[model samples]
Target: MGSLAPDSMVRRVYRCMCGINPGLEAPTASAKTGAFAASGVSREQLVIFLADTLRGTAEERAPLIMAMSQCGTEAAAAVTCEQVAEFLRDLISTVIQIVVHRGRLQGWQPERMGDGSLGVKLLAEQMCSELKPSDQGFCDVSSLEDFIFRVSQISLYLEMLVAEGLNVSLSGRPTPTLLPPCRETPWKELRCLLDLPTIMFLAPQLPDRYSAPWRLVFSTQLHGESFTRMVAGLSKRGPTLLLLKDTKGHVFGGFASHAWEVKPQFQGDSRCFLFSVLPRLRVYTATGYNQHFMYLNQNQQTMPNGLGMGGQHSYFGLWLDNDFGRGHSRARPKCTTYGSPQLSGDEDFTLDSMEVWAVGKPPEPEEGEEGEGKRSILDVDPEVQAMMEMAGKTLHSQGLREPEEEQEQ
Candidate 1:
């Protein structure tokens, strides 16, 4: 970049990570409209900034931090923790700005991370908390390197999501430069209880199916406050996330990795998980202790009705009774399948709202979608189906076995 005297291309390309102050500052150029003041960043400084933000190793990035904290001073042997926090804040702000502008939703509408939700500042604090500081409250350089190493995880996701963003990490790093060729999420507008930061946090946790924007399939606000309506909306949709807000102001739910079925038996598989959003952010995935991952049964006199995830019949990690507007999250030690504590503010929580989002591309709708044939045991329990897929075994018996009478549940 330095060899070219007229770094005009860099100037044009570098604007607002959201698209602002148009360039990396140049020494001779008196433009206040670049990334920095006309005191100007030299080629070395630009290289350092790019290195620290993207592919550079932790050791390589540490000097840039020291330079930043000391503010061009070479006298200080090290920086104070307070200065470290300030430096982290500046970098975090710039990172988020770039991510919000050029990353995930580039051609799609970009949204600033929510202040109320988990975001850059909170992430910075969490990183700082991990540092081992000296009596002077000064973090050692090694500690800073460790912190940078941790930040690299976020960088990986950023690289995977943003067009020009990249990293040297990952056992087999993906080439994120290639644009996802698929059409943008089938939906036009996004409306839901989740904030942008919350969505960003959860998106990467999804298995391999990256690039599939979450599409809202059901919401109590959009549809009606009816459990039957939820069932109808979510029944055949592929992997989905169920979100609920309790009257006590807690938000929680679970991820079901396949179509939900109304059944007398436990369904779904290990990809299923229960999550809490508000009050705290946590996801409890399968412990492999139980195959009872997801259960959604309704209108059964003998068996418990309504939707439940994790735990046994009566005690569920998260449950929404078909009775509607009433639910509970119970765990003694923790929920068996997800290993989660009670999610609602109370053991049993009142329903404030409910929403369901289909996670990947919606499957092409099939003809004769309803009452097409007799129901099989595989239809009643999704775990068996999941197990079969994992074992790489064909369901040859599915076609051979005579279908049983659909159990009235």
Candidate 2:
């Protein structure tokens, strides 16, 4: 019964409505009850609005979704697919804007998350695919109502995006942690492949230990395009998320539950999953069909040399060949390991961009370990190192430091 938030938040909500109808006016009254009465919005409507947006069931949210799709127009008996797509587009844009403005960004560099239009389109198609469409290609009330009774991620997405985006607290139950903190990462530029909504979708699915701050160990933009360099970044880093963008702009990747090791055998647990973000937003988890969870092997003349997750050796659900920029996703009907479809636009995809983030807090320094010692400036960038060496610049620091021990592969 008590829905009175701070005055700033009250105004923010009011502005949201006003954005839809520029002619709407703020009520002269200041109190919640008084304002609702004066503004010509009923008390029951406000209660239902809070219920739907805050914690209502899918059935409770269906009506509001319809109304938002109508956009203040007269009651519609049915809404077209385009209407739902537009509604989703607005919701997604609002979530991104909230992340950019209200920021739990900490120190991670914020940049444009690329065009989100295709993601919205794919999301709409996925949602509508469940409905029994009307003769006129519209979603009637019965369609939406019946679909709501079943489990759906739509409600979850709405809640997480709004709650995390607005930075709202759910009384004493809310966790202070949102995205894992980005403190003390060695990388100067901590920009990444995850849009705020994409992170909101993927983060909660991870294990609890990953709630600690994340580290940016590899990025194709900063690190040279060498599979060896990528492997170097992957080694010793506990539990990592790898995101890649293909030439067609489809973005997808997989989670590694344990630190990566270059062995011929597959490694990782069922907690590992695959996710697609750019052209669609969906996660495909393990099916327990087989133990082919993860595979990574390099410098092998006998075995396939690259990184892979799910399915089988050459026919992987997700694969990145050691050739660096070229790879294939060979899931036909579905990937047996995670039940995921081919994620890339094509089976043979060209890598446009890639990044890796190590989850959990960095290990505490060993006794007398003194300085954690910075990595070489060119450790990730071999081409840059060669260019600097060719320019006749002396790397006096390399000689002065203690020779580093080689890590066990």
Candidate 3:
């Protein structure tokens, strides 16, 4: 009989790979060799097999890392794309044999690099890929491209989830929640600083709670509305995230447990915090003392609307006054109310770009939880707590509900 077609071979390998469980280690060499042999694909054919199978690198990092670990190869050292593909094929077929035929998960390990740094490897819970069905007979060029794009989107979204520390170990194995970033846009620099993985680790979603996957809800530049007007659509959504770029090239924003409302009073609980994304990814959760300190008031007619960036007083103000060209606000930047590394506001910088996203779910109070609200930081620095004391007292003492909206004269 004729040898199996290249696509057939790839399907076989993919089937084997899918069979491997995330919790197991890589199979032995002899077993791997035998699987490929059974598939009728020689060593020379591995590259062609891989080229015909996988595509896209930006979101393929997790799968590639796992494959390399199983094959006892490392990608830490500079390697060509072809070499990486070859490595994946070798591991896939071997894994298929061990997991499918033998009915066992691959026991994968991180590679030890030349400098002794442990190479990147996916945790048992993080190995989620939604590639084309392995059993599917054949794929056309357009179909393959479409497949790669979908996979890339899934990978990007997963990375964002992981950044929020949603990966929890269950049954002695880390299990990540089911889900679903790369693209060119104005927020690139901000996102780079606010790395998705870091966000996952720092601000994880609460357990058993419903949180809608984050989606870009508003863009001041694209929407061409004042911040107050933009928030109209966003306020109705669940939790909210605000990302801003000042004219000075500074990128920062805030995460609020409360909606972006134009109430004439400060109306958020302790779930509001600020962050700076350009210099680095750091989150400033509520100081707790300022339980009701967030507000959105339309500033004086010419001055722009006022946003309480959350602090003791109204320190961290992100005003969106006039619409400056090129995705920026004409309002001056101000210092953050309570961010770790204070976010300084500059009057010189117009709003560069402002993006608002509706996060998964609105935070709910739990019995004996660290605090209230999902965005509430369980751990607070002693210094920060002490500093915020006076500010907290001020908020309580002064009836600082909302900034006075200019009366319609």
Candidate 2 weakest ten by summed lDDT: 21-30
Task: Output candidate 3 Cα RMSD.
Answer: 19.4
Candidate 2 similarity to native, TM-score? 0.69
Deviation (Å) of 299 in candidate 3:
6.5
Ranking by lDDT: 2, 1, 3
User: Which is the leading candidate under lDDT?
Assistant: 2
lDDT, candidates in the order shown: 0.64, 0.68, 0.41
Whole-model alpha-carbon lDDT for candidate 2 = 0.68
Question: After aligning candidate 1 to the native by TM-score, how far in Å is the CA of 64 from where it should be?
Answer: 4.3
Q: In TM-score terms, which candidate is top?
A: 2
The whole-model C-alpha lDDT of candidate 3 against the native structure comes to 0.41
RMSD of 1: 11.7
Off by over 4 Å in 2: 1-39, 116-178, 183-191, 361-409
In order of appearance, the predictions have TM-scores of: 0.64, 0.69, 0.39
Q: Taking the tens digit of each residue's C-alpha lDDT, what string does model 3 give over 249-327?
A: 6777777776667755667666666665554445566555445446665655533345655543323344443233322
On the 0 to 100 scale, the lDDT of residue 261 in model 2 is: 89
